[model samples]
Target: MDLPPLVEPAATLTDAELRRYARHLTVPEIGCTGQLRLKNARMLCVGAGGLGSPALLYLAAAGVGTLGIADDDVVDSSNLQRQVIHGEAALGTPKTRSAAARIADLNPLVRVVEHRERLTAATAQEVLAGYDLVLDGTDNFGTRYLVSDACELAGVPHVWGSILRFDGQYSVFWGAHGPTYRDLYPVPPAPGTVPNCAEAGVLGVLPGLLGTAMAVEAVKLITGVGTTMLGRVATYDALSARWWEISLVPTPGRPAVTELGVGQDEDPGCAVPCPSSAEDAPTVTAPQLAELLAARERGQTDFELLDVREPYEARLAAIPGARLVPLAQLESGEALAGLDPHRRTVLHCKVGARSERALRLLRAHGHADVAHLEGGILAWIAQVNPAQRPY
Candidate 1:
């Protein structure tokens, strides 16, 4: 099909912009007219992690007029491997601030807004408004629904993408154009059943492939020069290096409109409030955990500390008297059935993220009294035994 002639005005590229965007303008599909639309477009990227890393970099380079980054995390040393937006020097800094600094250095033409907090029902509409587009690069369902609902209410288009291991999924939802996220993912996966990037793991370069596709969709939306990914979802398998597309249509009962916020739970998929809750929703904190372990040491309790780190990590150092259960094998129904749900139990992994997931999984299978060691075994090493080393 012949594409529409992007009617947007030609942007006045400055000497720096002209130099930076000369390549884009030279393309017949983009040229000067498309460049102008890009210059005037505003976009919000949720999460400054794996996907956000490349999405922000490309948006900055594409000269999107304004970019908003929202994240409530800090830069950890481990994040540098895939969260390319941050560097070694930025360790321990707020993610939004770190991403903003990097965007500024990459392209001064793009104005950057930073929100150093998680997106919630209260703040989702407020933060998502005033932007022409939204990008979903978050690693969990809670934030994804928050962004999709906010964008649907605000009448803004969103490009959604997710990466895990060798696989990734992308979709475009513009309620005005077609189905919203609610129409597509009508229900979240049972809470802890789907492990996030932190637990399941993602290849560092995976985001670059998916995020760049998002940037492409955003550019298409602004310039009106080509087919938008709206109503379509894209999936990529890195190992096979192949791409597939899926079509999404609005559910019959839902109507299309431009509102600023949807009532919570009005949509079936948005019913779950938090990502960690679906599987029995068990949780435990540091102080509570400390007391339990102490009781075990004193022979006051009969519970075991289940360490879920991989054998390699467990071999480096492990909690005294703790049993090892590699995280990958955690999905087996019988892997942890040996534990007595009647007794208080503490589950841990290398970092707390995996253990938290494990705790939820245990809770799913009638293990009602399970508790995850907050911050995982790493926290134990820090607070309980400083001299103990970890892999």
Candidate 2:
């Protein structure tokens, strides 16, 4: 919806600011008046990874006067594929700092605020306060909920995006003006039910496409130049090269979000099953697993090496002799009917998280002889086979 501009125009633009945004000023839709509104806008971005990378760069280049970056993660080699804001030399550097340096080079007139901490329910409102709008590129559901609730309570409009493998989706949520994130997904998905980018992987250029769309939404919201995606969701399928839209309305009987509580149920890092005792939940190291596999081959032992990762991941790289059973099927009990109850089972995924969930499911269904690989297939690649590539 095109409402009044979110930000009032600054008193006047400096000669350099005028030249820097001349391209924007040339557009009748975003002339000097709109550029000045962008200059007065303050936006907080909840992540400095993936979607945040292009969003931050474009927002800075567009002259959003004040930008706040909230993230506690550092740059890793793996992130360079899509996080374009950070370079090779920035490995191990905090993402907030790395992004700020790049933004300063792109547009010195833009002020970047570094929030070197995670946005929890305790800190969400305080961190989000005074911002004209929020752009959330966070991955985990916990952080997504926190950002949504904080924006709702503060009555701020937020642009949100999610990318997984070949699929991408984005929308705007303004609780006071229209539907919120909870309207699209009323309750958080069960832990381990959804795989993140690390588990599912993504097209390298997909984030740039979706993140730039998010930046456009922010600019439109700030200038009131176009109809914002306040009540509709836009989806993209990279593999098919198709774009679609879905209408969303506030769900009837949905409870109002009056207070924010930081729940651990959706925290990605804490998704592993809680053990009754240390011994009850046993783990096998990569070397131990290799030895056990060798014993099974020699008919000295009997066990099933269950791979709980998606089939695509297995096609990329899989441990020899491991059977494929995607985590979703395992979680839903559909894959259990085919398992051999007599054989001891050792489960694993890309890392240990998904397999731990599968282990818990098996144990809950009366399969007693079960354990997960400690560090999962990644560890096996490092310890058992140096030749294998780590995804």
Candidate 3:
């Protein structure tokens, strides 16, 4: 659908800007009028991670007048593979600062606003209200929902993108005009079921593929020059070298969002607990678990200790004596047959999330006594085995 230019064209473009955007001016669809609109547009990017990296670069080069970068995290060494906006020198710098510095060098005509704090339920609306549109490159579900809801309330259009190991998805979401993100994903996936990039990993160029697409969508939305991806969700499978798109429409009779915090609770990736799930299974602190190990060693107690992380993660580091049982095996049900439900059992994973999932699975199978190690093996390593290396 073609949206009437969301931003009004500026009174005039400087000679430098016109020269810099000379190529855009030649494109019939995005000539001087579209270029002017882009120069007047203000966009807020919700993250400075993989997707944000490319989107920011392209948007700035395209002559967007103002770009707001909102990110509280710092550039990590691991982020270099796909977060191209930052370099090795920016390792300890805040992502917002690193990205802004890069954008400045890319196009000094583009004004950069650094939003150093993470957007919370309290600040999303106020910050988003200032922008004409939002580019949501956030990773976790909690931030995604917050961006969508905040955009809905602020009456701003957002271009959203997601990238995993070999797949990427990008779409434009506007609550007032077409389907919002809630229309695309009505319910958040259960926590721990979907792994983050840190755990699952991703192809180095997947974000680049989708992030540039996100920038194109933003350009379309800003100038109304081409049919925007307002109601269409597109997917790219890099492994197959395939691209596919599916139409998305608002859920009929779905109640309009009246507030934030819609799906925020479903993301266990965040520090907060998942309010949607009641999986408050028993847990033991690392110190308490150490005591249990000693008692078992002294022949005073007996229990089954299970590790539910992936095989690769086990190769990195693992607790001694804990039998390996990846979460996938437990979910498949065959692994349960080997375990005696009557025996006391304990579960642990990389962090507390996966082990919490395993504990729920064990309980569902009639395990009489089961508990998960609190904070998973990382906590155990910190409290019990400081010499152990972390992944």
Candidate 4:
């Protein structure tokens, strides 16, 4: 869509700003006028993680003037695989601070604002206000809807990008001008229906491809030199190396988003199932599972160790005696064919989330004695068997 420029040109570019953006000046599409617009734009990026890493770096290098980073997480060793904005030395440091430090080195002229807090109903609106545009790089459905609603209420254009494993998707949403995230996802997916990057690992370079595209969308929106992805969703598959597009339109007579969380059902972040205190919802630690397995082997006890993960994961690594019954079969009741409700059973998956879901399913089916492995196979590998490889 050929939308008007989101930002007006700055009064005058400093000598340093002009020299810094000299290459952009050479482009016929993004000349001095477009460069000035970019300098005056205020862009807020939610979740300084995978998708945020490359977007922030490129936006800073393009001199977006002011970039607001909102994230409550810190850098971990796992994030190093894709979050290029943070280095090895930044481990344990807040992501907002780490990203700001990196941006300072990339473009000292651009101002970086660190929100340093999670975006909840109380804070989303306040954080989104005054920004020319917001880039939604959030991971969970909870924060994704929050950013969309907040941006809609504030009437700021939003560029949303998502990456998972070998696939990626991105689009632009502005309720006032076009379809919104709500239009794309009218209702939140059921908890545990979709897995996160941690549960289903991603290629490290995938985010860089999608994140850079997100940055391009932001720049186009700011400068108004190119058509924006306002009403279209672009998808990429790394394995096939193909790009596809899907058109989107606002639902007819969809109620106005007069309130925050209008499209949100619940805030189940990544569908993580934390330990519960209820009597029926029992959980066992990795060490405890190990001991239980040992005691069962010694004929001291009897229990079924059910691996709720997929078959391919079992091929990679699995507990020695666990039986593979994928979570889907359990959820669909197909696993009931050979089921023994009388037998004590323990369930586990890549992480504890799906196993907990499976446990709940069995509990609903009158399984009197059932528990899920806390922290799942990863924890077991860390505690019971360090030799087992992790995906």
TM-score of each prediction: 0.83, 0.80, 0.85, 0.80
* Per-residue lDDT of model 3, residues 325-361, tens digit only: 9989999997999999999999998877788888888
Q: Rate the local accuracy (lDDT) of all candidates.
A: 0.77, 0.89, 0.88, 0.88
Superposed Cα deviation of residue 93, candidate 1 (Å): 1.2
Q: Which residue pairs of candidate 2 clash?
A: none
Indicate the TM-score of model 2.
0.80
Q: Which candidate number maximizes TM-score?
A: 3
For all candidates, the clash counts are 2, 0, 0, 0
**1-391 per-residue lDDT for model 4 (tens digits):** 8898888998888899889999999999899999999989999999899999999999999999999999998898879999999999999899999999999999999999999998877777888888999998988887787788778789899999999999999999999889999899877676566788877779999999999999999999999878899999999999999999999999898876665642233564322122333355578999999899999999999999999998988998798889999988988888877779999999999878788778888989889899988778989998888987676
In candidate 1, which residue pairs clash?
153-259, 352-376
- If the candidates were sorted by their lDDT against the true structure, best first, what order would they fall in? 2, 4, 3, 1
Candidate 4: misplaced stretches above 4 Å? 261-265, 268-341, 349-351, 356-368, 373-391
Give the C-alpha miss distance for residue 375 in model 1, angstroms. Answer: 7.0
Per-model RMSD to reference: 4.4, 5.5, 3.5, 5.4
Deviation from native of the Cα of residue 67 in model 4, angstroms: 0.6
The residue-by-residue lDDT of candidate 1 on 259-333, one tens digit each, is 334344332223244334424445555556677767878988777678888787777768777788766676876
Better of 1 and 3 by TM-score: 3
Tens digit of lDDT per residue, candidate 2, span 1-391? 7677898999899999988999999999999999999999999999999999999999999999999999998898889999999999899899999999999999999999999999876778889989999999999877887788888889999999999999999999999888999898776766456778997789889999999999999999999898999999999999899999999988888877888764433353221122233255678999999999999999999999999998878987899999999989987879989997767999999877788788888888888899989878999999999798776
Judge candidate 3 at residue 355 and give its lDDT: 86
